[model samples]
Target: MFRYLILIMILSITLAGCTEQVKVDMQGAGETIPTGSTGIAFDGKDLLVAKEGLIAFIDNIDTATAGSIYGYEGHFYFDRYPITITSKENKPYITGLAWQNTAGNTGFIWASDEANRRILKISPQGDVITRIPLTKIYPEDITFDGEYLWVVDSKRKKIFKLSTEDGSIVSEYLSPVPVPTALAWDGKNLIVGGLKNLNNPAPSPDNVQIIKLDPVSGNVMENVETSRYLTSPAGMVWINGKLWISDRNSGKIVIISDKGEPSTDIRSYKLPAVAPVLKKVEAKEDKNKTAQDVDEAKRAAEEARKAAEEAKKAAEAAKKAFELQQKK
Candidate 1:
């Protein structure tokens, strides 16, 4: 009987050992950041990352994060470190960023501030050139189509075309779906994707599908579904003819070929932990409520398990004592 029990224990341990570990392919070469990395852009050589309200640049496609943009040669990368240009005003919750070079001399960075419902144009030197007021409540994503800037009104289920020069809204188009989270332009068509506020009770589809649309008319051209590759697509950038998309919830960036085929996963570098600041009252309240509920449930489960074990041991001991008395 003891031998049989020991065999069962061994098998149980073996099965537990065989359980799959979180098999993250760490094959693609890049760095990993904390939780919320929403935007990624590549300028020929280096890569740019934007999270929260800060931007950072990296040199080697493999190197994830760089400290300062100065002294970096080849392709200039942008970092969140306040340069003379971005340091003067209050830092906005920057979600989307696009850069355009006019006349090959002056470069402008178009950034979207979701919290402020506005977009700002920053010069290569980091100076805020202009701020465009947006009627959309939450402008989560932004992209450029050579001549115009496209902004995603995530909460309003709409897309707005704004003049790159003054941030003036040229036109707005209602999205056929809900929650448009990301935007990309393939020279001819604009691609958008996010959760479909579908009626089904099951969670919205995990796939990241692109809605190809005419850049001029804002009319849907075709739907390209990306289920096998992307989980939840957020920010995207077209680099060297390939599309690089950031998966906001999955902590991954998927690279798609110009033909819209899944190519490789862009490597993300691990970023240094930033000090946690409880600035917003609502954020703090939500944190407290979540912590309290989790703690209470954990404590209750532990207590119940402990009581069950104690009762089982006591019962075993009592049975042994009674059996010995009977023998006596």
Candidate 2:
């Protein structure tokens, strides 16, 4: 009986060695602000941006918590933003950021380390909870649809649905777009951004498109031409009833309204919040006021003209009444 038990224990040990368990690094690493941001995610209240080698969280898009992690500074469109960063030993290139509720209310930020070929689960407070290695595929953009996490494997030409518990692949299929760059969930459908045509040297701005697809079957439901002027879109998110996309080359974020026809109501960021140091003119009244003032002046002029017309009609009526009395 003892000999039989020893043989069974040896067999179990051999099986365990065959499969590698994911290493959960609780210590985390040193923090460094990324040189550039590539992806963005919103966690109801805060906005998380994925930089090349770091993940930054902006508490309310306007303000951030101050500390070591949040003290790291970075420039967005020439303006300085107080950004919180995620730490890693040898900062691997990160491309995507997605909010997941794997740990209940605390929440977790899912990041795709493209260079290292792995996915990292980080706490909202900048702690690296765990990492799942993707040995073969290169992940670009990632999106979470309530239950499962989906990743765009750019190099493999595939989109994969991964288990949140362990970054194990649940299912994967060929992407409808040849070179998919951005992914977003719009309540019911998965919206993907890709190049319309392969321009040999580089993709043309006019050929950029955002395609809506069935999350399960990956069928093209709608193809919306984004803009004839936008550079290849990098990150996309549905926020405040509009689709916000970032251009890869220009590093500018553009807002597109959800119109039935291909969106023409597109707006691009003109400049950063704070002007450059040398160009720090006065407090500078709101640029929006100029447009508003023109509209207000036009409205006042219109009202004055209407009043004058009404007054002229009243005088004419009085004059006609006087004439009728004289005739009587």
Off by over 4 Å in 2: 1-36, 59-90, 102-105, 259-328
List the candidate 1 regions with Cα displacement exceeding 4 Å: 1-35, 62-91, 198-207, 227-229, 258-328
lDDT tens per residue, model 1, 150-214: 88876777787778776766676776446788887777877777766534354334534576666
Specify the highest-lDDT model's number.
Answer: 2
Candidate 2 lDDT score relative to the true structure: 0.65
Show how many residue pairs clash in every candidate, following the order shown. 12, 0
- Tens digit per residue, CA lDDT, model 2, 130-165: 888886568888888888877886677677778778
